[model samples]
Target chain A: MNNKVPNNRAWLLVLPMLVLVAFSAIIPLMTVVNYSVQDVLGPNARFFTGTEWFESMLNDSALQAAFLRQISFSLIILAIQIPLGIGIALIMPKRGWQASAVLILITLPLLIPWNVVGSIWQIFTRGDIGLMGWGLRELGVDYNITRNAGDAWVTIVLMDVWHWTPLVAMLCYSGLRSIPEAYYQAARIDRASKWAVFRYIQLPKLTNVLVIAVLLRFMHSFMIYAEPFVLTGGGPGSATTFLSQSLTTMAVGQQDLGPSAAFSLIYFLVILLVSWVFYTTIMHMQKDKHPHGGA
Target chain B: MSYQLENTQRGEKYTTIFSKVTPAQRRNRNARSRWRANCLLGLYLILMILPIYWLINMSLQTNSEILGSMTLWPQNLTFDNYIGIFTNSSWYMGYVNSMLYVAMNMLITICVALPAAYAFSRFTFIGDKHLFFWLLTNLMAPPAVFLLPYFQLYYSVGLFDTHIAVALAHCLFNIPLAIWILEGFMSSVPKEIDETAYIDGYSFPRFFVKIFIPMIRSGIGVTLFFLFMFSWVELLLARTLTATNAQPIGMIMTRTSTASGIDWGTLAAAGVLTIIPGILVVYFVRNHIAKGFALGRT
Candidate 1:
């Protein structure tokens, strides 16, 4: 992890990434910043608005509600998917034909385009035609994603879990595989129970991958747009409208560039803060623990 | 007396060994656990595949059949929906455009990310960590936030409504991810390899292309996979950037649903077709995906 070389010439190698990322990220980001502080009356008519847009966005009740909903939705999915993924990975066949078969099959959901995922769910959950919706109706559960906010929320969460849990499972499976056989052999010699083995061996080894999974899922879920947009149109009274949807509405739909730009900065900041916290905490955890004694 | 005591202790040990589960019991336990694992996996697989199955089932049926009855399987299965997509210009062109931009984005992301990832993995430099984190900040920035700006930016630059615009736009996220994933794989390779290549009198580019690239080939595969998947699946930016000529399949699907009432059969067909390319890619890179994912440290 340590490098003795102090050469700044390495920047040459990184220049392409910087240029590409800047073209895609930095310039647009700067544009957002520029828009956030100015009132764009027309192409030629503009006024410096200062922090007014930021203050107004902070005061907007709908945006605040969307923010809250986004947080809760992210928390719920991470809670469900992390453990479920780990469990699936734990039970997944370690080797042979079944492993490869399961790997390919389970990864199917991940490869589907985001809109297709939503579309697939959209059809799958239609009360008149789709299986899930029809089945729920036949069972007299009174389910409808279009009309019921609860149903919409549940459907979105379910769709996300179905779509993304495989990612976490795959990460954990590889992490599990990377553990040397000697650890398991040692656990067997000690007559360790299943839970004990998981706690002391598997869980510890999976810490790194789990951290990545949690952070990735959290960030991705926080910024979720297309699937929910295609599936619910951020409706059932905006019950499933998350941060990204709200931002899209302000920025693209209404063209409220100034406020949306401010909102965008705030949104970016929240993700950065959370990811930094998650990263630091996990790194700290790893630092405190001694390396396990095995290859 | 001593001999008798030793004999009794050996007998106790024998009894303890005998008290352990017989071979039949062990086999039963193994079977029970295996059965449990299979049941869990089977149930999960069904849950995973059922919606997809329903989608495919709807794709095979006519609109009337899909709406009129709650059939578990298609009753009057037809290939009309599939035929519709192939025959329609907009429908099939959507796929072509989507693939074009996605492929372009993958190429761009890997080309830029490879050397940058190598730099981050190998060398200490001025503001490296800050620069690295800054690049990643783009990953967390919601595309919705940049939709208006990107639209304006690309349009003003006269790149709007082109596949290149979408490809470049996708780079905001994919480049960061590629760098992150590739750096993880690169760092895992010992530093000695780079030094060894240098000592062999190979130039930096040659060593990089010939020696280093092949070493992290799986990493590259994984990076390509992530880049392709993200670029292909991403709709918000892709939709915002292109109106018609470069419109992605996702946009086409959304437009169809809203332009008319929901055309379940055609939509289902489009959805099914969208999944095929991904399935083929996953099949080829099945070996690398699991490992690639693990190597993509936070």
Candidate 2:
């Protein structure tokens, strides 16, 4: 968008990132690729299994279910967080000591370590000791995450919303702030209604930050593990055993490296594929961005 | 882009030209809307703080008090949990190790990502788009998937069980994020800054260090804040990479369970301590972050 100049020599600036990232990313990735195609019984024992592990993992019903659950969870999160975040951002105090205070208060939930977030929620939701749990029961609603799948699902979703909505809000808030005052002044001169100004000016301007927000929330929710692992331990049954939880069980708990590695590649591909779709579709909606038109 | 925005503005001009509102009426409506917005925001902040308040309550209470009926406030308030962490080596050392690696990761990520971001924002080099997308895929790569591979890779390199090992592993993710956010911020700065600086007879590195970096200081602050957050909260790689010597405070919180069963009181106290560092970091960058949030200038 900046009319970015074409210059291969610019790679010099990118070299440090390339080297550091390659050392950390490429090596581990190759190892995963190597493991995905073979069975290693021990240090020296290896059997080249070809795509057998990938075949089995793709056909596996449990992995299939976890994949479906991951999709639904991500959708539900986006559906709630995106619009709610925009509303909060729109309402956020523009500039003052008030803005600073609200920003810090809103960010508190995001700061806690994931597992500690789990622990805090764990004690905070007990019927005997937790405020929410006790207050619910005292008001005549039966609730227990350890016993009910529905309750477990609700708690996880609620906890996630509590922890993550601030991120969405913060992203949208920043986007809102970036709009120059002249645009609003022009709207006022035209006698534009608030809704007209929002629809015509603010929402279109928000597209870039919204893209980042949506993608991040999707990716982070997809990789979620610690909070739920602690909160429900994959629940009353396997009700809330998400993709990461499943993968960890297979890899660490049961030590099924071949299938797990194959599964990992598939998992990575799904995220990449979905993200690519999302990125393209959102970018496509604003076709004016590419003045050169489709090649 | 300008043509399209103007076109939209023109379209909207026809839809509401007849509506005439007095200035006083507009002010009245603003005050009313502002009140409603305040109400919603206030309610949200209260809900957000509830769980945190509960955690603080548990931290201040004695063991017996925690297990007893839910009290709004800790009746039998005690500071034993806090004292235990301060006096003990294992507990406090966890904080030390966590802080060490997180600080290292922040420094490494920022130093590496800044120039890369400048390049991405300013140029269309060969494979630039593909390279940018590939780096982001690192962020999408599940840390769970990388656990075994990371441990084996770090261990085999003989960098295992050291703070540097954890710091480097985190760079695999943090550097990509820093680059992405920094690109957004850098692109917002007008190109004239670069052209003018170059024309002033400044060498590339001197211009970058002297003028360009200062202009994007807010972006750098936000990037540092994020690096601190992700590195501090992440336990899987940190745990897998370091066993004893470099174990973080998060690991200690997980290990608090003993023969008497998990020490809820002590665990809560440690959780509270972990949050303090984040608060300090946020406070330091509060204003910079506010400016950094407004990313799309052009």
- The most accurate candidate by TM-score is 1
**Model no. 2, DockQ:** 0.51
Could you give candidate 2's per-residue lDDT for residues B189-230 as a string of tens digits? 788988998989999999999999998888888888888888
Model 1, range B22-51, lDDT digits (tens) per residue? 445555566777788899999999999999
Question: Lowest-lDDT window of 10 residues in candidate 2 chain A?
Answer: A286-295
lDDT score for residue A295 of model 1:
7
Write down the RMSD of all candidates, one decimal each.
Answer: 4.8, 4.6
lDDT of 1 by residue, A53-154 (tens): 999999999989999999999999999999999999989998888999999999889889898998889888988888899899999999999999999999
The alpha-carbon deviation from the true structure for residue B147 of candidate 1, after best TM-score superposition, in angstroms, is: 0.4
DockQ-based CAPRI category assigned to the predicted complex of candidate 2: medium
Residue ranges of candidate 2 with Cα displaced over 4 Å: A189-191, A281-287, A290-295, B1-28, B294-298
How close is chain A of candidate 2 to the true chain A, as a TM-score? 0.93
